[model samples]
Target: MTYLCLGLSICVSIPTYISFMYIRTLRLNTRFIIVRNIVLSVCLRDLMFLFTDFVTSLASKPSYLCEVTGALLQYMSTCAFLWMLCASTDIWLKVHFPYFNHANNIYFYRSLSYISPMFIVCATIGGFRSGYVDENSCWLSITSQSMWVFYSTAIVLIVLISIELAMVACKTTQALKNSVQPANIASTKDPKQSRNMAKSFLPLLAVFGITWILGIFLVIGGTIIFDLLFVIVNGLQGFVLFLSQFLFSKQVHNAWTESKERATTRTL
Candidate 1:
C-alpha cells in the first residue's frame, strides 16, 4: 500500500511539475511565482519521500542516511506548506490592499517560505539530534517526542492559512453586500469581481488545507481508514492543483492560444 501511494504520487507530481514549469515561464504573474514555488516544493518533497521512505528501507542503509533523508523530507514538506501559507496571505493582502506592491514583496514571501522551514528543521535536529529519524523508516517517528516540533509547526501553518482565507471570504462578502468599490476589491467597476477573486482561491485552499488536515488526524491516532484516506487524497494533491489552476484555467488556455496564434503569424 505504501508503494502504491508513493508511485501514484510521483506519477502525478512529475506531470504537474512540468505543467507548472511551462506556465511559470509564460505567465509572469506575481501569483504564479508563489504557485510555481509551491509546486516545486511539493515535487521535491515527494522525491524525498521516495528516497527516505522507500529506497532507504530496501537498501538497508545506515542510520545517518535515514537522518539526512528524514531531514530533507521534513524541510521540503514544510516548505510546501509554508508556500501555501504565502499564497493564502498573498490573496488576503491583495483583497485588503489592492494597490499594495505585492510584486516587490515576492522576494520577502520567497525568503519566508524557504528559510522558515530551515529554522524549524534545524531546531528539531539541534534539540533532538538522534531523535529526528525513525529507526524503521527515514522519517520523524510519530512516537518520538521530537516529532511534535514538526507536526506543531505544520498545524500552526494550517491554522494561519485557514484564518487568512476566512478573513478574505468575509471581506469579499461584505464588499459585495455593500455594493461599494473598495480599493481592495477588483480594479474593474464590476461588483462581482470581489466575489470572483474570493472564489478563485477556494480550490487551492481546499486541496492543500484539507489534505494536511487529514494528515494531522492520521498522525494523532487515526484508524486504518484515515491512513488509507490520507494516502490516497494526499497523493492526488498535485493532480488536483493541476486541474484547478492549470488545466481548467481560462487564463492559461487563453495564453496558450495567443502564443500559438503569434507563432502562426510569425511563420506567415
Candidate 2:
C-alpha cells in the first residue's frame, strides 16, 4: 500500500506540475482550466492520503490525526469528482449547441464549478463526522453513518458521468451520420472530438465505479474477492487519474508532440 501510494503520487504529481508550469495552451483554454483543477485535486488527494497514512501509522493514538486526514481525503476526492462533472457538462453543452455564446460567461461558469464542491464537502464533514482512522487502516472508514455520505456522493457522480457519456455518444453518432453524406469539405466532425472527450472521461468513471461498486458489494455480501477489489481500487485511484490524462487528453498529446518537435530542433 505504501509503495502504491508513493508511485501514484510521483506519477500524478510530475505531469500535473508540468501541465501548470509548461503547457501555455492548456493554461489559456477554459476546458483545460477545469482539467487542471481536476489534476491538482487528484494529486493533492493522493499525496495527502499518503502523508496521512504514513503519519497515522507512526502515531500511538491517531485520534485528531485521523479526523484531519479523513476530512481532507473526503474533501479532495469529492472536489475531483465535482470538477469532472463540471467538465463533462461543459463539453455536453458545447457539443449539443456549438453556436451558444459562452465567451463572457465562461469564467463565471468555471468559478461556480470549482467553488460548489467545497460547500458539499463542508456540509458532509459538519453533518456527519464519521470518517476516522480505522483500526487496521489509516484512511476513511465506511461506517454506517458515513457510508451514505461517501457512497451517495460517489453514486451521484457516477450517474452524472454516465449521462455525460450518453450525451457524448449521441453527439458522436450525429457527427458520424453527417460525415457519411455529401457535406462541406471543412465541416467539423463533432463525433471525433466527442469520442476523444468520452475516452478520457470513461476511465474516471471506471475508477469511481470500481471503487464504489466493490464497496457496495462488500457491504452486501462481505466476500473475500469484493474486499480485495475494494482495497485495490481505492488504492489505485491516483494512478488511474494520471493514466486518464495521457490516454484521453488530446491537448496532452498535442503538447507532447510539440515538445518533442522542439527537442528535436534543439538537438539538430
Among these predictions, the greatest lDDT belongs to 1
Give the per-residue lDDT digits (tens) of candidate 1, residues 156-177. Answer: 8878988987887788777778
Give the residue spans of candidate 2 off by over 4 A: 103-114, 129-144, 180-190, 247-250, 259-268
Least well predicted 10-residue stretch by lDDT in candidate 1 = 18-27
Q: What's the count of clashing pairs in each model shown?
A: 0, 0
What lDDT does candidate 2 reach at residue 106?
62
Question: Which TM-score value belongs to model 2?
Answer: 0.79
Residue 133 of model 2, lDDT score: 35
lDDT of 2 by residue, 141-174 (tens): 6563564676788788879878987877776776
Model 2 superposed RMSD (Cα):
3.8
